[model samples]
Target: MSSPEHKQLIWNLIKDIKVGMLVTKELNDEDGLRARPMSLVQDAYDGTLYFFTSKTDAKAFEIAQDKDVCLTFSNPKDNVYVSLTGKAKLSEKRDLIDQYWNKWVAAWFKNGKDDPDVAILEVKISKGEHWDSTNNKLVQLFEVTKSNIFESSTPNLGESKKFGTE
Candidate 1:
């Protein structure tokens, strides 16, 4: 698929998945990485993603120290998984913060959209990889079984593609 088409496919795969794992590298800890569950802002994906976060949150601090980050989304029932790498930064842009605000996000802040702690974590996605299994359970199981018995080949699960920045 074309780049635009691939991006749309990714959006379709993840649009319903409300939560994704946000992975960040801890400051001064080269070998340590932290991952936390975060909800997408659900506006639109135009090579970027947004999440609501507290400016004082550890993630915000980590992003300030190192912009590189990874995000992961999955749906076991559908057998779809995505991993995205990007650069992230914190923002207090009220207009943007208000645009993506909803009751669920507001619950995290005591003063609604006016809270000082409310911040927007913007991730400029550079590239991503995804695995999508399109076969039915029976077919998938058959493939797995066949592969196991054959002992030399792997199962033909589904489409696996890499998208974004070459």
Candidate 2:
């Protein structure tokens, strides 16, 4: 499919998930990587994703040093999983802050949206890949079992595709 079509499909799969794990390089950590749950702020999918973050947070610093980041979104019930890699930067744009402002986000800041620490983390996605299964759990299990019994082929788990700025 086309880039726009693939993006829309990804949005449809992940829009309800809301939260995704944002992974960034942590210079001080032993593993050299850190993953944190972040709430995605957007009504629809575009090429970019936004999240509210504290300007003083470690993630903000990490992104400053290395803009590359990865975001993972999953819905076990629907059997959809997506991974997106992108460049991230912090924005103090008041218009965006006001646009995505909500009570839930306000809880993170002491002075609500007016707080200096409140900042927007923008991730301009470069590439994204997703695995989606249309079958329910039972059917999926059956397929796996059938494949195992036959031992001639692998189970058809779902549709997997890589899309975006490739």
Candidate 3:
């Protein structure tokens, strides 16, 4: 599929997931990588993902030193998973923050939109890959049994695709 089409498909699959695991490089730590759950700022995906974060948070500091980041979205019941690689930067754009703000966000920024600590993290995606599978229990059981009994062929586990430009 075309790049635009693939991006649209990815957006469709992940927009509803609402939350993703944001991975960033660890600073001065042996852990190497640190991942934390972040809520999506908007439902419409356009190769850029946004999240609200504290300006003083470790993630914000980490991204400042190394802009490269990864976001992973998954829905076990639907058997959909997506991993996106991107570059991120912190923004204190109040207008952008206001546009994405909702009641759920207010809980974190008790002082409302003017909260000094509130910041927006924008991730410009460079590439992504996704996995989708038919995870019905019956289908899986049959496939597993068939694969074991037949021993000549493997079951159709799922579809995986890589999309986006470098």
Candidate 4:
């Protein structure tokens, strides 16, 4: 898909999640992952998810080592959730930080970027898959009820696992 479309899908699914469990690798152990609930930091729909975090955090250290992080946003009420896994880049540009900073973020930015703990986590979309149930429920029912009859009038979006690979 095109870049704008790709970014939109991500923004729509993850934006409402507000707070999500972020899965980042543990620097001490490659096989270990550290998960935390954060008020999902984000930037504009430019195909990259930006998160405001501390550079000294364990999760940050892991990203620095491999840049691969998984961010999950699930709405229990809607039963819809999306998880994004990708490479990350730490940015300290004032403009980028200012664009995303809000009154709530003042506690961290107050000390400024030079603060040993301040940093931005930028995740590059490598591949992402989301379950769009509002559109899928009817189709799912049809498939189950007509398993031996008519089928496949609409393709599943979850089937599209190809993005950023080409």
TM-score top scorer: 1
RMSD of 2: 1.7
Q: Please, what is the TM-score per model? A: 0.94, 0.94, 0.91, 0.74
Tell me how candidate 3 scores on lDDT: 0.89
Q: Model 2's lDDT to the true fold?
A: 0.91
**Comparing 1 and 2 on TM-score, the stronger one:** 1
How well is each residue in 33-91 modelled by candidate 3, as lDDT tens digits?
A: 99999999887777788999999899999999999999999998888999999999999
lDDT tens string, model 2, 5-117?
77788788878999999999996774699999999888987788999999999999999889999999999988999999999999999999999999889889979999989
lDDT of 4 by residue, 103-142 (tens): 6766766686456667777777777666656545676656
Over 60-123, each residue of candidate 1 has an lDDT whose tens digit, in order, gives 9899989999999999999999999999999899889879999999889989999999999998
Off by over 4 Å in 1: none
Better of 3 and 4 by TM-score: 3
Deviation (Å) of 22 in candidate 4: 2.0
Largest lDDT belongs to which candidate? 2
Off-target runs (Cα >4 Å) in candidate 2 are 29-31
lDDT of the structure predicted as candidate 4: 0.70
Location of the lowest summed lDDT over 10 successive residues in candidate 1 = 1-10
| Local distance difference test scores for all models | 0.89, 0.91, 0.89, 0.70
